[model samples]
Target: MTKGGMESVELFTSEGKGRGLKAQKEFLPGDVIFAEPAYAAVVFDRTSTWATTTPWGATDLGRCGWKAAIQRGTWGCWLAVADQEPAVPRGAREPMASWLGLEREGSGLAEGCLVSIDDLQNHVESFSEEEKKELRVDVESFLEFWPPQSQQFGIQFISHIFGVISCNGFTLSDQRGLQAVGVGIFPNLCQANHDCWPNCTVIFNNGNHEAVRSMFHTQMRIELRALSKISAGEELSVSYVDFLSLSEERRRQLRKQYYFDCTCEHCQKRIKDDLMLAVKAGESKPSAEAVKEVVQLSKDTLEKINKARMEGLYHEVVKLCRECLKKQEAVLGDTNIYLLRILSIASEVLSYLQMFEEAADYAKRMVDGYLKLYHPNNAQLGMAVMRAGVTHWHAGLIEAGHGLICKAYAILLITHGPSHPITKDLEVMRVQTEMELRMFQQNEFMYYKMREAALKNQKIHVMPEPSNETSPSLFHKKE
Candidate 1:
């Protein structure tokens, strides 16, 4: 894609999928198809209570109304800070038809209560009873904060938008840790359809790692980049859910959260499903029943690990991962997705616990598995390799760590632009690791002495871990 022209992709009506973007020309890995600025971005902050004018408040209105505001694109969103003035209207609001992305010329949809809003994505129909109940709770809560002046717009409009957001809302993340900090809509981003293994990846380019606040929010934009070679006229697609998951699980998430069943090749044909769930069964080979049994067990263990990790039970996460891994390694292939999941979680959790040697081992194994499954320049692969490198570095395996770090740096240079904060940090790590590798080679004894001293003073990081922040203890001066 040309930096200035944004000509690589064009919006087209995709068969089966409605509005979708497609490659207008061939695109190599790393080529950015296009970028879309946030249509309605609101960074949630405790310091600043937000306020927006009635009917269409971007920042001020709570979640549901915020989506409606972005759809209209008329109201200026305001940050309620001391001495800060309320945002004025951008212009006269567009007609309700345009607000809904209706093509009044060909399709008469101006008067209908369609689930698809012009602000974000497609229509959604399914909502579970629990979801309906939760939505009403949200609506009731919204009513508490909603100003009476805007009561003219009936509950039907609010209910309609709540459903719109249920499926289409995008979480905004901070740059450094990729931590969720807010929500926003980039309507054009919705044009890309879903695939299990997409040729393109969406990047939230926030540019800054600082807290999402006034003025800086403008810096947030979404970029769609080719994950690999994409042929001209091929429909551009992205995964709506985690691709690491089994086809059944991935489809379930898509149907429940996104209200669409993925028709991607992997999902339709059960590609990777066997390998992901396969269990070793000696010479006889595992039966489908056997595979299902182990898969269920693995899922249960993983569910526990997730809960433990979220609850900050780092030790329990590590223990459960080890137990699962012991069973998995005995019964599953080395590259089994379930084993990979345990390794991935264990590596990070062990790192948080300051168990660098164990962490490095798990991290290396996880990276090896990822390399087999993911494209060479896959962002997740690059990050996995980078984590493995950092873990090795912390374990004082300078040479091995340096090599992996450099490899990751090269891959990330393509997947994530050098301007990206992650890529920049990896560059720094690469240089630092390279320097240490050289110094260790020059005087191995002094290096170990320094490392031991550094480790003695280093502290284990706590939960809600700071990502990629663990530096080699070589910074501490040896006595």
Candidate 2:
């Protein structure tokens, strides 16, 4: 129920959805709606044992694979320490437990400070009987490994804690971009609901460096920014899944993970449009084999390109990306998500190489894909436009360059704000393009004016003294 002192938003219960946040006042794009530190957070070691390779085999869990192991270890350690010490006041328990309702729900419990009966009931009701059974066993193992003095508080309590963590934990990444280093629960921030097309974005300000060596030393603060102009009383939402995904895929994901059906405007429109397009084209869905092939090709190609990038093989990266783009475009069409991703990479690599014409072409395609796939104020759109504009400028297409740059500036202003590094960079580009365009127009006008004057002078020179010529001609005719 915390508003975090943000005048623009307030806590409210969304219809059918539980408690959520809504706008209290109008918000312009890039406006900081609220910023808050996590009430309870755990920073884990970035190095995972699972990533280590041994003679037996390479064992690596996908992203955040080490989370469950870290959670179990922490719970075990907490229980062992509690057993040796006197019972502490409920208020003195870990900040996360209290913030997440574990303390209140587990009140009257003799041991296992993390256990919460009420929270467990709420959690279990959300899952099917089969899922509940599996969860019970998993919860029991964590508790049985490190039993508290009083065993009265059992698996149900442990299940609740796990449920809370699973549902609410936010992946804390290093400034190095999308690499998960830890997880934190910011209860106040989690009140915002999910929408397939979100109007706000979450940004973490950890530090100036692109990557931090240790999460323990990093101080992270989460900031919520308005992605577009939002009217008062509007719901504040952020996408939990990739917004670039198709409507059907997004809904399926939301149902599986968040346990809710999305009825967002984007979903409705996209579904309807897709159906209409299919009907008009008389096209049936692709076979599973074809779909599988495309997916595998996309994954394999992207992995190779990423490897080349990490190895600093820019030429290979560009060549691989171009080849992938051609295959993907033939199979997935220009607007497909996979093709868009390839275009983005190709555009960036070509621009870095100073191949302005090629870069501009790729960048323009990315802009088109983003426009079709992303929300109106999506930051990626602004970035794509900016890249295209810069390349166009370099290619000497002043009009197109200036126009696109201006468009990018408008979008970036709302998404990144005037003070952001990206906004500042775009502002500089916009100014440079403006000056260049002005100079171009001035030169063009002068050239036209000079040519007009030269033409008039030539005509006068060809006419020769009119009166003297007329008199000589008349005299010669008379003779």
- Top TM-score hit: 1
Q: Model 2 over residues 70-165: C-alpha lDDT tens digits?
A: 111122111001122232221112222322233322343223222222321134567767666656665554444333543455565556555655
lDDT of the candidates, in the order given: 0.62, 0.57
Number of the top candidate by lDDT?
1
- Pairs of residues clashing in candidate 2: 175-210, 176-210
Q: Return the lDDT, model 1, position 353.
A: 82
- Provide the lowest-lDDT 10-residue window in model 1: 470-479
Q: Write the per-residue lDDT of candidate 1 for residues 181-208, one digit (tens) a residue.
A: 5555455566678887888777766555
TM-score, every prediction: 0.76, 0.61
Candidate 1 stretches with Cα past 4 Å from truth are 1-8, 45-124, 133-144, 151-155, 212-217, 281-297, 303-307, 441-479
Model 1, 377: alpha-carbon shift in Å?
2.9
